[model samples]
Target: KHILRYVRGTTNMGLFFKRDGTRRIVGYSDSSHNIDIDDGRSTSGHIFYLGSSPITWASQKQPTVALSSCEAEFMAATEAAKQAIWLKELLKEIQSIEEKVILRIDNKSAIALTKNPVFHGRSKHILKKYHFIRECVENEQIEVEHVPGKEQKADILTKPLARIKFKK
Candidate 1:
């Protein structure tokens, strides 16, 4: 009954994707800084969309604990990039997409990491699985850019915020 009640409340919660919508697929990504009290691992959150409607969204704890806030955000961005590429391929199968996916991340350091070739000592310990995003960047399949934290929509999934912040 609780599940049914929640479902009823979510009657307006739906995503609309149109065939004629713009081929531009964009993504928003965010992360919490050491929110896990037990292991101190950060949580990564991402949402991808076809035009304005979201096609995919996820929020999960990072397997390894991050050393810094930037590292946590960087890992979250990497996860988003991975999903963007997958969605691109899926969309290509249904229809041709002209515009490359643009990923918006709130952390500037994470954006810089995507462009930087040399990995610093602190970042070196990150799992190799996340480097797939680097390959996507080099191939120009996805581009990560800086976005101000105040406007990061994915923040809602990653961490709690004030009602005013969430409303914006």
Candidate 2:
């Protein structure tokens, strides 16, 4: 099987965590819009890293159908934001994490929606729960920033990628 072959090829490879590295938590969130043909729902994906090593990740179908790509991505970011908050709290018990968690997203519109409180007609249909990320941003708990699509690590979890691209 292709998965078996790939696993065999990287049997010795693994994530390395540096003791002297930064303790900040960084997250990458992405989505595949309208990926589910049966219901036209999207797939949300996210990866959280402590320093350069990945600590947590997720890939799951959105519960609600998204009408637009921006909506799908916003929902994905919201999911990641929730995870980031949990991680922040966990880390606090060990050692204080003073810096705000950085959540990287590939969609510009989604980033804008989180940073701006203004309600737009296009986003009026989004569920109220998904707007929790905006409150986190307002409280200085998480900071959402733009990441280029090609550099979004969460893409690997959302959909299949070429072997060469996946290696990156």
Candidate 3:
């Protein structure tokens, strides 16, 4: 099948884990507006790295339609935080490191939501499960930082853009 052929051709592509300390373990997450006209669901994407090389990445549709951009980004960060915790556990078992995992998201509103515990009317509609990111932050398992939208690489998987625009 064409899909199989494509997979075979891209077998060389993947995350490269390095023992060198030149890189830092960090993650990036992004999401698109609800653009699936039929379903109204947004896409979620995340990528992790050990320094400059990638260690894990994924792209998938959100389970439900996001009521706003902040919601979509929050979902993406939740997924990324889960992966970050898993990766940290894996690294501890196989190697020794004393650094906390860091996650980068472009949505300032989402970042604010995670930092603030006051569940007001705006955030009341978010599903309960997605609040796990806050717990993870409190436990020091993961830290979410704000990155500018133009610098978010996870944008590649969550939406379509022109070649020139994407490269930027």
Better of 1 and 3 by lDDT: 3
Candidate 2 C-alpha lDDT tens digits along 60-152: 999999999999999999999999999999999998798999999999999999988888999988999999999999999999999999899
Q: What is the TM-score of each candidate against the true structure?
A: 0.86, 0.94, 0.86
After superposition, the stretches of candidate 2 with alpha carbons farther than 4 Å from their true spots are 1-3
Best by TM-score: 2
> Where does candidate 3 clash, by residue pair?
23-51, 24-51
Can you write out model 3's per-residue Cα lDDT over 86-166, one digit (the tens) per residue?
888888787775688889999999998878777989999999999989998888878889999888988888988777765
Q: Residue-wise lDDT of candidate 1 within 74-158, one digit each (tens)?
A: 8888888878888888888998985778999988888877777688886788778877777878888888888898778798888
Listing every candidate in turn, what is its Cα RMSD in Å to the true structure after a full C-alpha superposition? 2.5, 1.4, 3.0
Positional deviation of residue 70's Cα in model 3 after best superposition, in angstroms: 0.3
User: Which stretches of candidate 3 lie above 4 Å from their native place?
Assistant: 1-20, 165-168
What do the candidate models score in CA lDDT, each in turn? 0.84, 0.94, 0.86
Q: Where does candidate 2 have its weakest 10-residue lDDT segment?
A: 12-21
